[model samples]
Every structure is written in C-alpha cells, then in structure tokens.
Target: MTEPPQTAEPSPPSGAAPAPGPAPGVTADGGPSPQAPAAVRRRAVLAGTAVSVLLILAIVFGSRLLRDFDSALLPYAVATVFLAFGVAYRYTVWISAPGARRLFRQGWRSFFSAANFRRAPTALPRMIATYLGFQKFLGARSHARWAAHQLLFWGCLLAAAITFPLTWGWFTFTSATGSGPGYEMRIWGFEIIGFDALGFLGWLMFHGLDIAAVLVIAGAAYFLWRRMKDRGAITGQRFAYDLVPLIALVVISVTGLLLTFSSIFLHGGGYQFLAVLHMVSVVFTLIYIPFGKFFHIVQRPAAVGMQLFKYTSRRTGEGEGEVLVCRRCHEPIDTAPYVANLRGTMRDLDLGFDEWAEYCPRCKRVLRGAAYLDHVKKGFK
Candidate 1:
C-alpha cells in the first residue's frame, strides 16, 4: 500500500517529461532543441543563392540604364574611380607585404643598375624577341595561351586608348587648344591609326575572348560539377572567392555575347545600350582586377621580373653567394652561372632580362631550374 501511494506521488505535469534534461542533441537551458550545424550551412546556401539571383537581375537592368541616362559625366567618373581603385589596391598590397615590397625594391634596383645598362644592353632586345617573335613562333601550348591572353589584353588597352580620347576629347581638344587640332588630322593620325587599330584588334580580341570564355567556363563548371559528383572533392570550407570569379566570368561572357549579337533582338535601337553596357563591364572588370584572382595579371609579371633580376644578379656575381634552394625539389644549387648566361643572352637579344622574369625562353617558368624543368618535362611529353 505504501509503494502504490509513492508511485502516484511524482508524475511530470501532464505532457511534460522533466523538460527533457537538455536531451542528447540539445544545448543547456530549457529552450527549443538546437539545430544541426548542417542546417545553418543549408540556410547560408539558400541566402547566397537568393543574393546571386538579385545581383544578376541588377546587372541586367542597370546596364540597360547606362544607355538612356543623360549623364555624360557618369561614364568618365566611373572609369576614373575604377582606375584609381585598382592603382590604390595594387599600391597597398605592394607596400603591405614585406616580400612584395622587397621584390619591388629589387626590381627597381635592377632596372637602374649600371651593370644592367652597361653589360646588359641586349636585355631589352632579348625580351622583345622572346615575347613577340620566339614565343609567337614556337606556339608552345603554354605560350599560345599566353599569346591569346596578351592579344585580349592589348585589345582592351587599345579600346581604352580610343574610348577615353574620343569620349572626353582629351587628346583632340583641351583648355590649351580652344577648338583643338584639325578633325582630319585627328582622324587620320589618331582615329585611323589608334581607333581603327583598336577596332580591328577589338574584333580579333572578341574571338579570343570567346575562346577564353569557353575554356574558363568549361573548366569552372567541370570543377563545380566534380565537387558535387565526387564526395572526396567536397570540403566544409568552400571559399566564396573561388566561385564568385567563375560566376562573374560566365556572366561577363554571356553578357558580352548578348551585346554583340542579341541586342537587336532584345531592344530596338539598343546599339547605344550595348555600347554603354560594354563600357560599364570593362570598368567593372578593371575595378575588380586588383582585388580578385585577376590580380595575377599584375602580380605574375612582377614576380617574373623579380625572379629574372634575382637570377641575373646571382649569375653576374652581383649577389652575396647565397645558394638557392629549389622550392619544389629541395635541391641546393648555385644560380650564379645560369643567371649570368641568361643575362648575357638577354643582352644579346637586346631585351631587358630584369624586366621580364615571368617568362623563361628556355624553361618558360618565371624562375629557372627545377620547376621550369618540371614544366618542360610535363609540357613536351
């Protein structure tokens, strides 16, 4: 009888069960159960997807507005701001990193070194030949890709050369010259030579862009698909930096093609719109250039230049005889003689070896030795 009474003494209030005692998967404090970390990740993915969609829509609509706006000043303002930002970013990065700053100093010192100009007179010629002639003629797989990149780069440069001068008449007329120079001379001298060249190169560049876009998009898509298909490739810490550029590049390519071919179908008298959008895209690309993966364009060259100078200095008996350890193979090697020969060859070629570290005519890696050897072996085979 006592045991039966004790059994009825303490039951959890109606539906409750001691407030669950913070259950197996729950945090302390009697609140709703905690969610799985995966749930939070899923929520983030959804949010990112929504944001991306919004961005795409904004780019589409905003680009259209570029045409009808009566603001002639906006384009120039945007372009200037973009250019300034790029310069500022580069400067900041260059100054902030000790390695980068050291490289810059080395590069500058090499450029002005008496030995560079005296014994290395042919450096400049060698650089030009290697870059323009030999690299172009050999058509090595890597070299070919580089040439295509250069073509697009130069085309963009020329297009900008034509656009700014024409847009602001900065080259044609200035405060110094009231009415400016004659139109015919400007057209013949600047337009035909500069603008026409840009246009022709731009047309060629469009083809290059198409090819590049296809390759890049294919590569990125393959990677993304692989991440989904292969569990081994998936990691918890997937970087947005990796995906953003790939997506942006795809958008750029698609938009560029639309501007080229689909404008007429989509909007009446949309040529102006296309032009403005193209210009805006170019500006956007420039603005992102220093911050994104595209920063490689600037950095690669500088890295190459630094390597070139370092090698050349060692070879020419200009360094302190410190042996270089190959980063890849961990092999210790004296770089002096190789650097000397390279400098000599550069002198003979009349190219500035110090200026073009990014290229190695013999090996094609930024620096000579093991990595270049590896590249050669893999590339040729």
Candidate 2:
C-alpha cells in the first residue's frame, strides 16, 4: 500500500549538496543489504556476542554447572540462546537510526533516572498497567481485536513464565519418592514445593502448557480468521510478517495439545511423533521471533519507559516550556520539548522537514492534500 504523504520544506535552493541518507531502506525490494555498512555490522556483532555470552553464563550459573539441566530440553535451551543473540543483534541495528536512537536513549534515561522516579512514582507502573498489561489503547480500535490481543498476550506471557526457567534449568522437577503420585519442584537447586501427581495441583501444574495452548489457539484462531475474512487485513497482509506468526502459534498449540491428548486418551499412540513435531514448531518459532511480528513482544516494554517519560514530564511541568500550536489549524500540537526533540531528530536525519513537525496531524493532511491537488492532479490536466 502507498504510504501516507510526508510534508517537506518547499524545494531546496538551487545547486545545494544532497543531504546524507539517514533512513534505512525498509522497503528495499531485496531486503537488507548483504554488505551492510561496517558500523552497523560491528554493532550487531558486538551486541549479539555480548548477549550470547551473558545467556551462556546465566545458564551455567543457574543450572548449577549443568547438573540440573535436562538433556532432553537441550534443543529448547539452544534455541533460546540463539533467540537472545538474534534479538540483541536486531535491536542494536534498529536503534542505530537517529530517531530510534533518540527514543532509546531518552526512554532509558527516564526509566532509570532517580529524579524522574521520585517525581512520578506511579507513572511508570501506571503506563505499564494500561499500555502493556491491559493494552487499553487497542480497545479504542476494536473490542474483538482488544480481546484477542489480551488472550494472546497473557497466554504468551504465561507460557514464557513457565517455559523459560524450565528450559534454562532454573527450574527442575523430580519424583518426591522416586515414583509416581508425589512430585518435588526445585528452583535453582533449592527445594521450593511438592505436590501430588494425581491431585488438583498436579493436574494444573502438568497441564499448564495445555491451558496456555488453548488460550493461544483461541487467540491465534481469531486473528487467523480475521486475516482470512477481513478485507482490510487481506489487502495489506504479507505471508511472512502477518500470517506465519499466527500459523506457527496454531501449529505449536495444536501439536502441544495433541501431546496431552495422546497421553490421556490415545494411550501414547502418537506421543513420540507429536513431541518431535511440537519441538520443531517451537524451535522454528523461537528462531523466527527476531525477524517477525513477535519482535514487537520484545519491543513493547521499552515503550513503557517512553510513555512514563512523557507522562511524568507533563505531570511535573518538568522540561517542557509552552505547548506548540499547529500553524494551519491553530490548535495545540504537543509540548515544546517534545516538538523540539522531534525537530532535532529530523534534523539529525536530514529529513529537510523539521518544520513539518510543528503542524498538527489534521493540518499536515490538509497541506498534503493541497500539494497533491496543485501538483499531481494539475499535471494530469
């Protein structure tokens, strides 16, 4: 689909040198360049290496020198190690751009600042509650979408909370008496709790993944249904970015639930094959996370910091001067500091349209419409 029109300064004076290309080629027909710029490659490599090393160290420390690590869960652990590296690498590349770098720096600064925390103690958590926890913003668009997202988010959250520690060896389960009914749980080599294998607690514990699978299946199915049926989604969706995540989720969930069914009802008829299929699905999904829509799961928390920064600033009358007003509509656009930060980012990017940020969204659309009429429509005549 065509992108929204951008407002720029009227044509530059004659014979000027072109500005540096600061924007990444997001829509480049051939994907990212094979010979990426040296600096970008360097940053990605360093970040990825650092992340991998830290993950390795964590696994080593948490697993008590691999004593608690299950050999059968090796594939899951390996996939997560790669996942951490890939996520860090992509994140480093993503934040190298001027706009994203600005946000990254400011978000962390506000997130970590003692003064900001003191001034607005509840701001960060509040943003996290509304934005990340409940995803209240999605409600403004569609209630169905909001509900689906909540299910997906909570399901994924629960799954990660359960799986990561287990895969990483931070958690381990053992037979309390070297037999069936009773079980013992350990956290980082310390005895945490015990429960009966056939009791309600054991049913919930053993079937937790099944519950997560059901939630994910419901949520992913809703999205998949919408993608298949909704014209708006169908028109813009890409197979890799849009469809595959949901498909993978459904595959993982179904195959997972099948493992349970095979154990309970099928008497392990297809349990071994189902386990292999489930593992492959999960491994592929983990490897694909950094490159696909699921990367947003990693990125969303950073936004809490950004939101906290803005909210605290507004509430405390901290850094902002007067609010900036739009030129065309004469209505408020945003706080002066925010507008200035935007202009600064634009200037750094050599966008040649920092002034455009001063106008509210409505006026910018009006200006773009006028320009379109004067230029493209007039030329057609």
Q: Cα deviation of 326 in candidate 1 (Å)?
A: 11
| Candidate 2 ranges with C-alpha deviation above 4 Å | 1-36, 318-321, 327-329, 361-381
Clashing pairs in 2: none
TM-score of each: 0.46, 0.86
Alpha-carbon RMSD, each predicted model: 19.2, 6.7
Question: Which sections of candidate 1 miss by over 4 Å?
Answer: 1-73, 124-240, 246-257, 260-268, 271-280, 318-381
Residues 1-381 of candidate 2: C-alpha lDDT, one tens digit per residue: 144436555554456655645333355222224556789979898999999999989998999999988888899999999999888988887777777778777788888889888887888888889989999999998999999999988888888889999989999888857887888889999889899989999989888888999999999999999999999887756777788999999999999999989998999998999999999999999999988788888778877866765665565564444667797788977766667878989999788989999999888898888898898897446
lDDT of 1: 0.49
**lDDT (CA) per prediction:** 0.49, 0.84
